[model samples]
Target: MYRLLAVDDDPAVCRALFDYFSSRGFFVATALSAGEALRLSQTPPPFDCAVVDVLLPDQSGLKLCQAIKETGAAVVFLSALGSEDDRVQGFLSGGDDYLCKPYSLAELEQRVLARIRARQGTRAQQVLRFGPVCIRLDRRQVEVEGRPLELTCSEFDILVFLAQHRDAPYTQDAIYRAIWNQPGLDGTHTVQVHVAQLRKKLAAALPEHSLIQTVWGKGYRFSPPPTA
Candidate 1:
């Protein structure tokens, strides 16, 4: 089932979304604020899409949309402000679609479904394969020899970043900043710890292969297997 997160401070709107999407066979999760929306996003089985209101009590939905995009979920903005500049700002914030307030729920549903379908359609091109290991970008899932591999959100993001770059090396600070979406905060130790844990897990899964390689004085690199 496609999972969705709806973030709107209006209780009526939240309830309507929950009810409408639920009836349409979607697993809907609603949050009344950006903080709540972020908290809900941390849960496993990440959301496939998020519907966010432009204005929120805690923070702007544009900021929240950027964070949601980090989870690899499509975002659609809902707003009462329908000006061209407002729509442009929404798209700049990584929103896939925008709907003006007083909108039809049916049309909203179609827009959301269309974005989900588009993401799924691109899944084939987004997948990463290295021998028995496979990474599905659309679903944010990793498998080894057809067995599902459980990983934390950070670990998965780190792996995806490195795997996409293939043989290119990345410093620990670079990886940390990229994955955490933060700048200048000393993440070397934290990155090392996560990379260590990730390496241990990968090693345990594939004893004969080393996918994440330590680049001596540099940092780390994803070295695909020779047969890959």
Candidate 2:
């Protein structure tokens, strides 16, 4: 099951999302404050994503997203303060998506599923197969020769982004802009760290082959499957 964290100061909103997502087969954890959300991040593995309200009891959702990013969790900001700046800040803080207030439950489910699918490193009906590794997007899991491979949040995101456009190269600037939302100079290292970490994990899990390849002076791309 995909586990999610729903952070909001309003008890009603928290309960509503919990009940809504639970019925749709998601295991939802509710936090009434940014402090509580921070506490939940310390929990062991299996936490897949988060939905945070911009206005919390003591802190902004953007701030909470920063904290969650350290734990490598995919985040979405659902806020009443639905301004362009608010959404941008959410992304800058490492949120995968931004949602405005009074959102439909259906839309929420779709976004949640998209995030989960992306994390599993799959998209649509086509299972991503690179070398000996396979990923099931709908199931949100990665497997190497039938065994599940553990991946951090960032690692999974990087892998999925690459897998989605196999054989297509993406520059460091483009990848950083897509994955890490921060701008200017300092953000450069963020993508590099994530890519390095992801590469190491993939190497450790499948050493015989490298799925993600460097493009000399360019950037990186997912190598296409070997021709039969």
* Candidate 1 residue-wise lDDT, 42-128, digit = tens: 754467899999999999999999888888789999999999999999999899999999999999999998888787675554688
Q: Per-model C-alpha lDDT, please?
A: 0.86, 0.77
**Clashing pairs in model 2, backbone N/Cα/C closer than 3 A:** none
For 1-228, candidate 2 gives per-residue lDDT tens digits of 466889999899999998998787666778999998898776543257899998887888888888887876788889887888878888888889989988998998899778766865544445777657887765667888778988776677677767765656777775654454332445557778888888888788778778889988878898754645
Clashing pairs in 1: none
Global CA lDDT computed for model 1:
0.86
Q: How many residue pairs clash in each candidate?
A: 0, 0
- Total clashing pairs in model 2: 0
